[model samples]
Target chain A: MDKFLCGIDLGGTKINTVIITNKGEMVSSYTLPTLAHEGPEKVIQRMKETVYKVLEDAKLDVSDLEGIGVASPGPLDAKKGIVLNPPNLPGWIDITLAKILEDEFKIPVKLQNDANCAALAEYYFGAGNRTKNFVYITISTGIGGGAIIDGKLYDGANSNAAEFGHASINFDGEKCQCGSYGCFEMYASGTALANFAAKEIEKGRESVIKDIAKDGKITAKDVFEAYKMGDNLAKELIEREAFYLGVGIANIIMNYNPEVIALGGGVANGFDILYPIMIKTVEERCYKASFEGCKIVKAKLGQNSGAIGAAVLNIVFSKN
Target chain B: MDKFLCGIDLGGTKINTVIITNKGEMVSSYTLPTLAHEGPEKVIQRMKETVYKVLEDAKLDVSDLEGIGVASPGPLDAKKGIVLNPPNLPGWIDITLAKILEDEFKIPVKLQNDANCAALAEYYFGAGNRTKNFVYITISTGIGGGAIIDGKLYDGANSNAAEFGHASINFDGEKCQCGSYGCFEMYASGTALANFAAKEIEKGRESVIKDIAKDGKITAKDVFEAYKMGDNLAKELIEREAFYLGVGIANIIMNYNPEVIALGGGVANGFDILYPIMIKTVEERCYKASFEGCKIVKAKLGQNSGAIGAAVLNIVFSKN
Candidate 1:
């Protein structure tokens, strides 16, 4: 009999649930707004609803699942399956979501940080396939990453390995929210890109970015839109973004020396366009030998990476 | 009979060789000037002479040895036993020192980068003892490091893992020889400290450092001496050096999250003086959870780390 696995990607804005074959073939999936402002109870209730609906739509019972995995923003206790306080998911303090889900469904459950899950997803089914040393980086509102060393997730003391976002790129530069000066995320993330665009326009620089941002609140996506229209300011911002990403990636190469670095998330959606410039910067910053040994590519799983990796956690870790 | 292992630390200015029991008890040691300008052939001959002297002093023969381990500056091919163009040892391109030793001794030989060897030595007998996740950082004329992941040395894809010195701390800052801008070494190394002091003196800041360097060739040691004499310039330079180290170490914490970060090398001779400020900066930069989970300390082995680690390489890897 074929075993099915259930995965739940818990986010600040939504809950994503999926029931898939052990091989990652999606049988049924469901998504719903979290309405998290209503509190943990309401959000978890929605999460459970999606899980049950996904199972039902797949014509499967709770017993059919190998196990359930939950991927969420961390500082959480992976071993205890508790969600620690995450900046994105405000007020989500020490909630045992894994236990809550397990008790309700009467099935086993596991939990891990979303970055680690995404890394696992890529290693098993995406750009990291067949590579023993791998790293997955997500450049969304913030930068974060997970490393796979010798074919296993490198969960550093307290599951905090590969928090590359907080690593500073400028010792005397901008102060970051994390109490660091010029952190990688502060320079290269989508939020940083948008903030840079806004700061530039505020300086009276001419650009389509301001015109495109009708309500006057510019987004990183707006910069990309303007870039397509041949706006010089937009082009400059994107180029700098690529350069910053390269700088951070070069540091990552120094740290892990992985065989492959798979980039995912919001900014990485522009990966193909950014790759050449980004790689050129990397080549300039690192040893020819180290850079040549690695293959940098766009992450394949995209938005579903977290859910897919979450689903595989119990399957991979338990079997080991 | 106890199994005996031999280790050699090949460096730009010197060659250090050691004989140790499998349990890491030292039996004999020898050192020789490298005179690297004379090239690889002469350097290798001296290396062989040291090996013979160490064995003779220990009252052991080549037949009684387990295997030989050679630790050198990298860009070398460890698997192929070839020394590939290390900048410190000029003209050392593709020299098969390991094979030459093996052929002469009729015993197995192993090779690794010196930084990795130091990490392994620390892991086996120094500050990293009983720790699974460890990192050893050496801050000298330049900075370098090696990581132990899940109780084993992480060699990465091409023996270049943990080259943390090259990682940029400021994307728009001073250019480094490695082509990166504002590398950790460019700001925090012993050489960097001396250079900063020289620059400050050139700007006409009054200090005992000028008197200490009678030949007008400033050294990091002179700055430390000036610091003891309460030289204001030296004090400021030391503080900034500590600050730069803190910034780099903060990034290291983000990248590896090791339980222990044992700092070694020339700059680290003053680790106690630098530690408090460095840790304070790290505390200010990283999350409370991660900071609490790690223990930072001065490396225990000091200069002998590389040679000791080289001796244990074959023991650790082959036994596994």
Candidate 2:
């Protein structure tokens, strides 16, 4: 009888569950609405039911499972298995996720941060498979990252190593939501682009973005659309964002010297205008020796990366 | 017969060699003038002579040594064991130092960057001994650093991880020597402080630094001395330097989340005025979570760190 591994990616709005064999073959998978507004207990119950459904569809019993891995948003205490109060996931404070899952399924369980899970997945199956040291950066609503150094996850002193966006690119440029000054996310994240565009429109700069915005509010998608249509204001905003993004990438290269930097999340998903400029800026800024043979590429596993990476945790943890 | 290890630290002005037992007890040590003006071949010969002298003094034959390690300034290739053209050491491009020593003594020889060698020594015998994840920074004429992540030196994809000074603090602040804008070294290094003071004096700013300058050239020491005497110009200059240093430290914390940061090198040795302000700035700028339990302290290994760390390489390499 072949053993199976389970991985759960728990988010604010949804939960993704997958069961796979030790040989990297998928056995079963499913997703469910989190409905976190109903609170932690209900969410856990729904998650348990979804896991059971996945196991049943795969014709697997609970005892046949090797272990379970969970990837979730943090400020989490991975060692303690507690889900701390993440801004996006309300009422998840002090919840022992690994213990709850383990008790329900009678198997070992491990927990990891979502960005780290994506990096782990990429290291095993995506852009970083051929590289020993790499950084995975997600440039979505906010920038998040994970570093894989010397072929292992670099969980710092407290299991939180790569907070890339929080690193400052301009020490006095702007205030960040994290209560810091001039964070990389304030200049380069998807939300930063929208915010910049909104400010420009509000300042009465003439541009198509004013028309593209819905109800006097511009989204990152709307700004991207305006840039695609050759709006001057949008072009300047994106160019500035790409420039700062390049600075952040150069900083990462200088700091980690990773073999590859796999770019993911919405803003980095092959945004034609931003991608080339950002790459060029990184190459131009970082030390020549550090940049040599370092690759900056798009992430391959897409949305499935987090779930698959979380699931693979069982194999990594048990073996190491 | 007891086993022994050999370490060589090759610098522009001098060469240091030492022989030690497996237990890290120093058996013998010696230093020689490098006279690098005579070029790489002569420097290599001198290094060989120094190593033999140390061994002879210890009454050990070449066969008694486990391995040899050489630490030198880089842009070198650690894998190929070649010393590339480092700015400080002229005519050192592509010199295979390890192979030369290996051929001469018939022992395995390992090559490492000086900063990395110091980090390794500190990790095993100094400030970072208590923590698995730490960053070692040397701030003197310029800044350099290395990271130990997960109990091993993080050499990155190219054996050049943790170029901390090259990481930008303010992307548009100043043109740096590395062809980047606003690098940390440009703002916080000893050379940077001297250069900034020199420029300020040229701008006709009144200060005791102008009187302290030797032959109208302001040095960082002069600036520090003036600040100690309550010179307002020097005070403002030192404060700015400390603020930028703090920003750089905060950036390192956010990027690597190391358990501790050990600071060494000439400028950092006893810069009491800058230390408190720098630490405060780092605390003010970094996310509280990133700073939790993380320490910024003085490096304890002193000048022998490079040679000692290089010698210890045998133990680390053989075991891992």
Model 2 achieves a DockQ score of 0.79
Candidate 2 lDDT over A193-216, as tens digits, reads 898888887898999987888897
Q: Could you tell me which 10 consecutive residues in candidate 2 chain A have the lowest summed lDDT?
A: A267-276
The sequence of per-residue lDDT tens digits that candidate 2 reaches over residues B1-320 is: 65798999997788998887776677999999999889998889999998889989999888899999998988888888999898888888899888988899999999988889889888888888748888999887888988888788888876789999899988887788788888999888899999999888889889999898889887788988899899998999999988888999999998888889998777776557788889888988776777875988888877887888889888788877
**Residue A44 error, candidate 2, Å:** 2.2
Q: Estimate each model's TM-score.
A: 0.97, 0.95
Best candidate, TM-score-wise? Answer: 1
Q: Report per-candidate DockQ.
A: 0.86, 0.79
Clashing pairs in 2: none
TM-score of the A-chain for all models: 0.98, 0.94
